[model samples]
Target: MRISATVAAVSGALVLSAFAVPAAQAAGSDAGSYRADVAKIREAAHAASGKAALSGSTVASPAADEPYALNVTFSNVKVHSGKPIVVGAAAHVSVPVTYTLTHGADVDITASDFLTGPYIYKGTYAQPTNMLFGEDAGTCTVTSATTASCKATIDIYPGDGDLSNVDAGAWKAGAEAIALNGQDPTSTTFDITKVGLADQGGFASPNVTRLSKLTVNAAPEPVKKGKTITVTGKLTRANWDANNYTGYSTQPVKLQFRKKNATTYTTIKTIKTTSTGALKTTVKATVDGYFRYSFAGTPTTAPINATGDYVDVK
Candidate 1:
């Protein structure tokens, strides 16, 4: 994924928490210097389903009554692997994004007024298929005068079927933030215009692969010191649609051998599977040892190694 110059700009700031004030410190009345009212805002911002919904039309460039101007800086977006999101067994995923909201002069901040989360949209910015991931509570902390750092952890769940029609490939990450009115939720809205779109570091679909199976066997269990010994195996992988494991024809499998009582195994040769994923090969049996078939995984499937089959040489 390529992050547009626009998305790359809004990549700074930190997380948020409930604004706290000591009994002696007076609340600032300036819009820009005001901190948010935590209690009332939480009720309006969060839904029972636990997913923050920021599904409103694009507000005019500068909406009226927009309490504060925004300077959002998102942290590097990454998956659990500390890399681009790699969809896998865990359908639900969360990515961390932080931002700093600078309040306007005398604009009191509240939870309801602020909402941030991760968004995925396909096509051009002018016209795109947009999907919101997660917008839960962003525990915030006030860092400087009129500046508050907020961190939001966004969640993505494929099972929700939001990106079902979307192709299984790269998707842009558009981190968003909005300021709403406590009295009138839809009144005025302000957002960071330039959200950082991750470059080669956005969302990814699970690389779907069929389950693969392999087998190994050795012939002439009691072979002579220098007799020719045969090793054979079949490599097959599951077909998702068919729900069965079938031949993985024309793929290569490494024939490996470990000497008796040895800890490591060395590759003897590379052999290709037949049209039916069948394997047959010969090697000189020198010592009682174990033979196995190893397959280097493909894009869609994971790598696997079969259990070693022992062959005894008299």
Candidate 2:
């Protein structure tokens, strides 16, 4: 059972390394959750144009069974990647490279093979492939194109991974010496320190793998009990490829509502997922319970539950 670990696999090539990391450590179990760590290196850090810092946590080799976090700063980074494309109704870019393609970053020496999937976080880790895609950071060496610099075009809002809780027990980052590159290399260091969950709504966490941020926005108003309130929302990050795999986007989302101050919300409506992956539905807001919602659909991606949840109001 070779897990497809590194890079993209040619059309029908056998993918063995894909599940390497998860398989080796847990051998059929998901790895312990990790958080982004950055406090240790924050002491001597200074704001310089060439300075950048990254901090995050990883599963301790079964030897520890605890979350391990580390922080490191990089200088003179050369950013590499194809290009960033906006996903759905968000102001972020989604890296559209598959596992077979090679994307290079100056901070990391080994040109990263396209990512495989997020297997360890959900259930038991698979063995075979022995690879962990879309997580961890790397450092690289540059040949000094004279203007050699370190660049990280974070298309997946706050880098790919999961929806990290801001100010919670989730991952956090801080960057100084900020520079912005238009449709290209950004020349500044930005920090995601002390950010609140509300601010990171449209961003993903450094802990999880996949950067799918879907926000269901609704007006903040009190609803009357036993009334039919008009419910409307806009899905944030929706991406669908109907041609690649069989039924990649199938199960639809059921939109329901609860009372503003009641309990036990029930399904009052349903909305089907579109080819674009974003769905805007108008449902009936039943009862006066807390406005809660969720998606009854599931995805073919990795990291346990590919099925989306209620991103917002009831």
Candidate 3:
């Protein structure tokens, strides 16, 4: 299996690249070569930002001084079906990616040594603050002699240092391809002239948000009509650094209600979370219904609705 690599900078920018190294080469002596090359580029990018350097292992072997640019372009790229990617604290999240590839007819994307896939990045492509990619190369179907439609997946693991809290926001989509052209990647004298590389950035923008959760509880399951009912709940969101969920404080949350037999819920009141993300409010018991807490969500956090808690009125 091809293992994914993540390049994380001290500025907390994480980069994931889906450079296609064959399964065999990925496990060999030079396994670190491709990653090292990316790390070096990341270091330069960070230095340009006047920020701390990126953290990564040294390159096991030197890479080509330069790679020949290939004739290729990526277009009509869409990520996560045009929806935000909401990732939780622990479990890995796999996002689907689709795009159109137009390349020189001579480029054999299907070759075993050729690697290509779509990625999402923040900041300029040349000096991205963060990037995300997949563990596998994109699967393509030829639409014409020079054009193809492709699909791939980008996997995110919050616990694996693949993300930080600051990473939750808008990201731009891009694509990259590398053709080894039969060169021995493990060889110390690997020739750069035979390598072909292509990169296209700023195709589309997608949102990535931290997963959010909510809970609702109405006190006194059976209450007399016109009596007071205490409603309480909590709002929490993923904390990437802690690998867990924590309170989402000071955010507005709505209390909503629906008649037992109703199909839709009506907003009762809007309240903000406490310092610890706790929610509490009181409503009069008038009829039989269900209550829930709803969050509208921010750019950095996903929207969520708690399961309704039913209450009986006697």
What tens digits encode model 2's per-residue C-alpha lDDT throughout 110-170? Answer: 3232111211112112111121222232222344432122332222332222222221122
How many pairs in model 1 have backbone atoms within 3 A of each other, for residues 3 or more apart or on separate chains, i.e. clashes? Answer: 28
> What tens-digit string does per-residue lDDT give for candidate 3 at 41-111?
33332332343223343444333254566777789999988998999998888899999988898898778
Q: Which residues of candidate 3, in runs, are more than 4 Å off?
A: 1-64
Could you tell me the lDDT of residue 183 within candidate 3?
73
- Greater lDDT among 1 and 2 belongs to 1
For candidate 1, give the lDDT: 0.50
Best-performing candidate as measured by lDDT: 3
By lDDT, is 1 or 3 better? 3
> Candidate 2: minimum summed lDDT over ten consecutive residues — where?
194-203
The predictions' CA RMSDs to the true structure, in order, are 12.1, 19.6, 6.2
Among residues 3 or more apart in sequence or in different chains, the pairs in candidate 3 whose N, CA or C atoms overlap within 3 Å are none
For model 2 the TM-score comes to 0.28
Q: Order of all candidates by TM-score, from best down to worst?
A: 3, 1, 2
Model 1 TM-score (2 dp):
0.47
